[model samples]
Target: MTEHRCPVMIVTSMPYRLAVIFLAGLMALLAGTLVARDAHAQPPHADPAWTDIVVGAGDDGRRLSLTEGHRLVIQLPANPSAGYLWQIEQLDTAIVARQWSSEPDYVGPGDEITGGATQQVLRFVALGEGQTTLQLALRREWESEAPPVGVFTLNLQTVGPFTGANYQYTVPPLTQPPALSPDDIYAEGLPTHFSWCEQGKCTPIRDQGMCGSCWAFATTGVMEAVIKIQDGVERDLSEQYLVSCNTHNWGCSGGYWAHDYHQNRVPPNEPDAGAVFEVEFPYQAKDVPCGAPHTHHEKISSWSHVGGYGLPSVAAIKQAIYAYGPVSVGVCASDAFGSYKGGIFTTDESSKCTGANHAVVLVGWDDGQGIWYLRNSWGTRWGEGGTMRIGYGVSRVGWNASYVVYGQTPYMPIGGATQPRVRLFLPAIARGGGGVAPDAAPVPTPTPVPTPTPTPQPVQQVPSNGGFEDGRVIWSESSQKGWPLIMNTGSLVIAPHQGSWASWLGGDHNEVAALTQSVQVPSASPYLTYWYWINSADSCGKDVARVLVNGTQVDTYDLCAARNTGGWQSRGVNLGAYVGQTVPLQISVTPRGPVDLATVRRFAELAFEVVGLDYRDYVVQDARFVRPADVDLLVGDPRKAKEVLGWEATTSFEDLVRIMVEAELSNPENA
Candidate 1:
C-alpha cells in the first residue's frame, strides 16, 4: 500500500491573521474543555449497531432484508423545544429487536434556544427471522419514550444475507462504514466547520433556474473555490458558457459537471478561454445556441476525480472539502428534496422519490452535530438561508465528489490515488425526473461580471449528443444492466473541461457498452474532433475507449494516459471519405479490472459538415451474433472472384463458396 500523506495546508486563501483566528477558535472548542453532552434518550455506551443507518435519510417505507449478523438503524428529524428530542415508543421486540439506540444529537451553534434542526437515531437487528414492522414516535420525556407527535414506521425483515445492490434514497439506511484512516488535521476533531463562513473559499448559492443544469452550477462552484484558494479572488464563472457551446451538453436538460470540466478537451463548437465572468456570459437557465467568447479570460488549469466508489468515510470527504473548498456532488434528489425548508434535511424510502438525479456542492460537515452542510443551486429561497444541513450520510452527498485546481496541470485521481487499480467512475448527469424547481429567485452576485468584445464564427454542428446529455437522446445502449459495464464504475460527473456534461464509458470484462447512433453527413469535408479525459489504476486493465465510423475502427485510446501527457487530450479525424455517407457512429468503452477509466473516456462535440442530416437516436443494445447452420462443405479463399465476377462477399468467405464446393466435388460425371 502506498503511504497517503496529507497535502501541506500551504495555500491559505486568506491572510494569516484570519486563518490563525479561525484555527484558534476551533482548537479551543476541541480542547479538553469541550463538553460531551449525555446521550439524550439512550445510554452513553450503546452498541455500534445502535447507529448503523448510513445511507437512507428518514422515509419509512424503506425496504430492508437484513442478514442475521448485520445491523440496522432508523434516523428522523427532531425539533428541540427545550433540548427536547424523540425516542423509541414501543416495538414487538420479537421479530425485530433493539440492541441499543440514541436520542437526537443536536449540533447547530446558537439555535438551541430557538429550536433548530436536530437528528434522532436508533439501532436494531433482526431477532430471529420473519419480517415485522418497527414503529416509533416523538415524546418530550425519556421515561415514557412514547405518545408520539408523528408516527414513523418501517418494515424490517431478516433475510439470508445482504446481496442486492445497495439502492439508497436518502443516506441508504445509515450503516457504519469502515473507520476513517486519513492524515488530515481535522480528521479527529469535533464541530469541524469548512463552510464558506469558516474558510471564505465557497461562493454564495446561485439558482440554476427551471433548467436541470445543476451539473453546470456545481462545476462553477468548484471552479469558484479553486480560484479563490489559489489566488484569493472569488469569480462566479459562467455556467452559460457551459449551457451553450459545450456540444456534449444539452444546456438546460441536464449535464455532467466532471466531464464538462475535464473530458471535453477539444470542444467542436466553441473555444475554451478559461472561466468567463458572470457579466460576460450570464446565466439564462434555458438552452440557447452557442455564443461567441464572452469577456473574462479566467480558465481552470485542470480538474480530477477524487474519492473512490463506495467512498470509505465522511472524514475523507471533509478532508478534501476543507483542503479544496467546496466539492461538487451528485445526489438522489426527491420531491421531498425540493420542498426542504430548514434543519438537517433527511431522506426516507417511504415517499416516492420523485426526482432521482441532482448535483450540488458539499461546503461543510459537522461531526459533533452529525450533519453535512450543502449549498444548493436552487437559490436562497430553499433550505436554511439557501443551504441545507443534511444528516451526514444523506443521499451520497460526498460520493462522486470533484475538486478543481487553478492553472493547467495534469489530471490525477482523487485522494491523490496512485494505485494501479482501474477505476470506473459512473456517469454524473441525466434528467427528465425533474420535480418542481423552486420558482425564480434573485441571484446575488458578489463579484462583478465583466463585458468584453466577442468575435469569430462557430464551426458547423453535428448530430449525436455524444456527451450522453439529454438523457441518452442521440445514442442507444447495446448491453444489459447486470454486465460489468453496467456497474457503478462509469458515471456522469460535473468535471468537464469545456461543457457542463460528457459521456462516461467505463470498460467491463467480456461485456461491452456499445453506444451507437446513425447520422447522415450534411456537407463535404466532414471532420470529427472530440475531447476525452483518461485515468488508469494499472497497466493490466483491458478497458479501451474506441471511436468507430461506419462499422470501421477509427482510433482507440486506453486508460494508460495516466502515464502519458497526463490529462485531457483532443484529437481530430478527417471524415472526408464519408462526408456524404450515412452511417452509424459507435463510441464504446469496456473495462474488466480494478477499474480502467476505459472507465468513461467520452467522445464529445461532433464537428463536421454542417447542414440538415437525417439522424436517428439509436437505443444501445448488446451486439448480438447468430450461429451458422451445419453444412458439409469446405471452401478455399477465392482471390480470383474479384477478377472474374468483379464482386466480393460482405458475408463470410466460407458461407459464400460453401454450395459451389459441394456441387463440384459431387459431380462424378466430371471425373
Candidate 2:
C-alpha cells in the first residue's frame, strides 16, 4: 500500500501538468469559437451599422437599411452641369464611397453631363453593425450661367442586418478622359474616310429576325432615306422585294450592294404597287429563294451608285454636313456588336471610344476639336447616351479609311426633275343599301308647321371634364393617358418584329383579347388605320379572329397570306371601313386548327393620322413592352401617370381572369 501511494503521488504531478495544459487548450478553443460567432453574426456591407443616407432628385433624405448579407442600391439621374457627379459618404467621419472622384471614375461627355439627362446607378455595401448615416452630394456641372456651379445634398440613416442580395453593384464609373493627341495620318488610313462627311447617316443592316436578310435591310434603309429626301415625302421602301425578287443576288445570307441595286430594279412612283404591297416571308437565317411576289410594286424616285477615292478629310466631311443633314456610311466590322446605341466610328476597340461598333451615320463634326460625332441605331442606350465622338484629322480608328456614303443627290432632291408623285389606286366602288337604286335622290317634301308643340324638356349637358369613361368612346386628348378602349378585331397586329407581342397567341383560338383597361389609341378619328399581328400554323391558311365593330361583322382573314409568321406580322386596317364608320370596337375568336381556341394570340398598335406623324414615335412606344409597374420603375420615380394620364386600373387580375373565363364558358364552341 505504501509503494502504490508513492507511485500515485509521483504520477500526480504529471496529471496536474496535463490538467493545466488541457485547461489552456480549452480556453483557446472557446476564444476562437467566440470570435468566429461574432464574425458570422456580422451583417453585409449595407447593414445599418455600415449605411449612411439615401437621397434622390426632388426627394427628401431618409435613412435606409440592409438585412444581413445584402447591400443597398441607389439610382441617380445624370447631371452634366455638375459633371454628373454623385457621392455617398459614411456619416461617421470618412468618405466611404464616391463616384467620379473615386477610383475607376466615370466622366461622360460634357454635353451628356449638361444637357442630356440619363440614368445612373450607384451601389453601397454595409460596413459594420449599428446605425449608420449616409450623405449624398450632387453637383450640376453645366450651370455655368449661375456662378458656374450648383450643389444638392441629401442625408439618410439606416440600421441593418445586411445581406449581399439587397443591393446591385453599380457599373464601374466611367471617366471622360481626353482622347490621345492627334498625329499625322499614314497610308493605312486611306480606307477610313473614303467618302467621309460631317453630315451623313448610316442605316444599320436590319436583323430581320431569323431571316438571313442583312443585305436587304441595309439596302432598304439606305434607299428609304434617299427616297424620302428626294420625294419630299418619307417612303417605307420594301426589303421583302429585294430579298425575294432580286434575281442577280442571293435572297438571304450575304449579298453585295452592286448586285442588289442592279438586279433589283425598284420602279419609281409605284411603291404601293410593287414595294409596299409585297408580303414578308418568314425570316430565316439561311438563304431561301424569294418565295412569293410582294403585293406592292417596288418604287424609286432615282437610284445610282457613287464611288469615290481615298477617305474624305475633316473639311470634306464638314462640307457634306453643311449641305445635307446626315449621310449613311459603311465601315469594317470592329467587334461582335449584337447592338449599339451611339454614333459610328472606325476603331476596332470600342471600349476606348465609349463602346461603338459597325454600321452608323456621321451626323456632324465639331471643328473646334476635330471630333466626328456618329449616330448609331441601337436605340439610345449605347455610346455617349447613343451618340459617339471620334477623333477626326489623324484618322483615329481609321476615320480616314475608305467608306461609302448615301444621300439625296441633285437628281433625288424633292421637286427635282427625276422625282415623281405617287398615285394610289382606289378599290372599285361597291353597291350598298340593298341596291334600292343606282343613284337614289331625296324626294321633295313640304314642311308642316304650327302643330301643337309640346313643351320641350330642357336638355341637360354633363360638365365636360377631361376624364375617360369605362365604355368605348373615341379617344380624346383629354383622355390620352387612359387605356385604349378600341379592340383589334383584324387578322394581325403590326409591331416591330422584335416586340414582346410578336409571338403572343390568344387562348385556343388564333385570336387574343387583352384587358382594355387604360390603353389609348393615337386618336379618336375613324379614318386612322391601326396595325396588328397574328400567326398561322401553315402557309396555306390561318383564321385569326372574328371582329364586330359597333355590332356589325367584319371580314375574316388568313393570317399566313398577309404577314410573316417567324417574324413580327404587321397589317394595317382602316377602322372606318367597318361599321360604316368607326365606333365601339369588339373582337372575338374562332379557331382554325386543333389547338385550343382560347390559346391563340396576337399583338397590335394604332396609327393615328399616318400621313404626317413620324413612324419613329409609334415604333418607340410600341416597342416599350414592359409591364406598367416596370415602366413606372424605369421611367421615373413616383410615376405621374395617375395624375398626368388620369390612368388607374379599374379591373383586378382575378376579375380579368373571371371575365375571360366567363366569356369562354358562354361560348358554346369553347364549352
Candidate 3:
C-alpha cells in the first residue's frame, strides 16, 4: 500500500474528526433503533366495524329493519368514545341513506349513536319489492384523538309483502266443564243464615314456606268438607300428593287452578313415597278409597275458624282467605294478570287471564278498600308470597252475580238433613299460644266522632328539571349520598380531557360515597331533573348508572346504555302528572356486573344538567349540529370547527393529548 499521509486538516484537528465520527455513529445507531421500534410497534387497527351493536324489538315483535314501513332499531354498546360518529346507508348502491354526524339527539330506536345502547326505533316502509340491502358505519367523532374502533356493516334485506299472521295463541274453552257441586251457588249478597267453622272445626293448610301449592291445599280443604258433609266424617286430604306428584302440572312451586282438580280427579293417586304429613290422616271419604296412609298429616283445624267469621262480599272473601284459609272463587284469565303481584285489587284492567286461563283460591280480602285476596301456587316469593288480590266486584274474575264455585263447602246452605261441620287448625295454639274462638266475643263497634272532613288537596304538576324555579337546586350535597350533580343542557362540550369520570362510579374505588349537592323540584310538578357521567373504562368494565325522579326510578343505563366514554350528555324526562306536591331527583351508579380491580383504574366520568323547558326545544337545537357532510373531518382545527359550529376549538389540543395519555395509562389493560 502506498504510504498515506494524513491530510493537514485531519492532522491539525484530530479531536474534531473523532468527535464527528462518534456523533455520526451514534446517530446511525439511534436511527436503526428507532426503525426497529417502529417496525415492532405497528399502528393500531382502526376498524369502524368493530362496534358493539345491539338489536332489540318492542313488545310488538317488530325489530328495526331497512324495509320501508317496518321499524328497525340499532343501539351502540356501552359508552362511546368522544368524537364518535356513525352513518346508515343503503348497501346496494352505496347511497348514503341516513347519517348521524353529531351526538345522538333522541335515544329511541334509531335517533341515537354516540350515547349508550339506546333502543332506536326507525320505521321504514318497504324499499321497493324484492331484496334491498343497508349498511351501518361508525368512527371516532371529529377531533377525537382515540382512533375509531367499532365500525360495522349491517346487511339488511327487504322482501315480500307484509304478513300479519304472527299472532299469539289463545286457550279454547274446555270441551266439558268439570263436575261441580250442586250446593255451590253464586249469590249477589250475603245469605240470611251463615254457619262457619268454629275454632276446632276445620283444618288449615300450611303454605309450605315459599312453595306455591295453594291450589292443592284449597282442593284438599274442599274435599275434607265434602267428606264431613256426606259421611259425617272429617278426613285430612293429601295436599302434598298433588304438590309432589303433579309433574305434568306445576309442583310445590306453582300450578294452574285446573291442575289441582285434574290431579285429584285422576286415578291411582301418586303420593311422594318420602313426604310426611304434619298430622295423622283422618277418616277416608266415600268417593275415594284410601291407598297407603299419608306419610304425615300436615293439616291444621283452627285456621278455618278465623277465616269463616268474615262478611260475604268479595272483600270479605279475600280477607278470610288471607287471614285463615284459601277461598275458592272464579277469576277472568286476562293477559294483564300474567305479571300479577299478590294483593287485593279491583280494576277494569283485563287482558289474557280471562275465561279461566287459571284458577286460584281467594285466601283474603280487604274490606276497607274492596280488594279480593287470592293465593297462587307460584311460590311465596311470587305475588306477595303466594297471595294476590284482584279488584273486588270489578268483574275481574268473570263473575257477574253468578260464577262457578268448587271448594270444600258452600258459602250459603239450602235445606239439608245435616249441616256441614268445618274444622280449623290454629298454629298459634300449637306454638304455645292461647286459642281464641272465632265467635268467642262480639267485635267491638267503632265510636265515630262527629267532625268536619278536611278539603282534599289539589294535585300539582312537576317541572322537567324537578325544580320549580330557575337556578333552583333540585339536589344538593347535604341531602343525598352517592348522587351526582347533573346539569341538563342542549349544547355541551364533552371530551376525554375533562377527566375520566363515570356516571355511576367517580372515585378510584368506583363507589359513589355521597353527592356534593342535590336539586329540589316542586311537589306539584310531576317531572324531575337528573344528570350523571360515565367513563369509558368503567363502562367497558361494566358499571351502570340509574336515574330516579320523585321516588320513581326512570331507567338503568349501563356503560352500554349511557354510551359516554369521557364526555357529557343530557336527557329530559316527563313527570308532570303525579299526585305528589314535591319531588326529589336522585342519581345512582352501581356496577352492571362483576368488575376487576385493575379495570377500576380506568375510571369513567358522569355529569348531569337539568332543563326546565320541554326536551323538544333542546333536542331540536342539538339536532341542528348533526350534518352528514362534516362527519369525516378531524375535530378541533380552525377549519373543522368553522365547518361545524362556526367556532374554533375552545378545548386546547395539548390538553386533549394529556387526557389521552392519562386515560391510556390508567386503562386496566395498560395498567
**TM-score of model 2 relative to the true fold?**
0.26
For model 3 the local lDDT of residue 550 reads: 33
lDDT of 1 by residue, 64-152 (tens): 77665566755566433121244555566555665432232332312111112335445566555677776665543422333456677
Clashes of each: 76, 109, 141
Residue 263 Cα positional deviation in candidate 2, in Å, after optimal superposition: 9.0
| Sequence-dependent TM-score of model 1 | 0.35
The order by descending TM-score is 1, 2, 3
TM-score per candidate, in order?
0.35, 0.26, 0.25
Q: For residues 1-671, write the lDDT of model 2, one tens digit per residue.
A: 11100000000011111000000000010010000011011222332333433434555455454433343445565432113334432354221222211311112322101112334445465434555455544532222233322233334333444443332222232212122211221111111222222212333323343233434444455454444444454555555655555555444333333223423354333223334422354434445555443455334343322224224544444444333334444332221122222332322332322211123455555422234565433334445554565544322222322222333453212222332122111111224643212233322222323223233222112101101111223222111122122222121122211111111123222222221111112222222112222333334333334333332233233334332212111111223232122133323333233231220111101121223332222332111111111110011111244557766546533344456655756899975
Candidate 1 Cα misplacement greater than 4 A, ranges: 1-191, 258-266, 309-312, 349-356, 407-671
Quote the lDDT for 398 in model 3: 22
**Per-residue error at 309 for model 1, in Å?**
4.4
Off by over 4 Å in 2: 1-215, 247-252, 258-286, 295-310, 317-326, 335-358, 368-408, 411-671
What order do candidates take by lDDT, descending? 1, 2, 3
Q: Rate the local accuracy (lDDT) of all candidates.
A: 0.45, 0.30, 0.30
Model 3, residue 240: distance off in Å is 5.5
**Model 3 off-target regions past 4 Å?**
1-68, 71-240, 243-266, 269-325, 330-344, 347-349, 364-367, 393-395, 398-671
- lDDT of candidate 3 over 1-671, digit per residue (tens): 32111100000001111100000000010010000010121223322221222353222223234433343335543211111234433444321133211122224222111111222222123333454445443432222343444444444555445342111111111111121111121122322112223212344433332233434554565445433443455565555555544444445333433223332333245343322332543322111233543543222222232223212344344333322334444443322243445333333322222222233455333322224445443345445555564544443342321112223434333333233232222111211365434223322323334223223123223222222112223223211122222221211122111111111122223333212112233333322222223323232434444444333344444443224312112222333333333433334443332221111001111100121222221221111111111111111223334567766344433344446656766799986
lDDT of 2 at 292: 48
The most accurate candidate by TM-score is 1
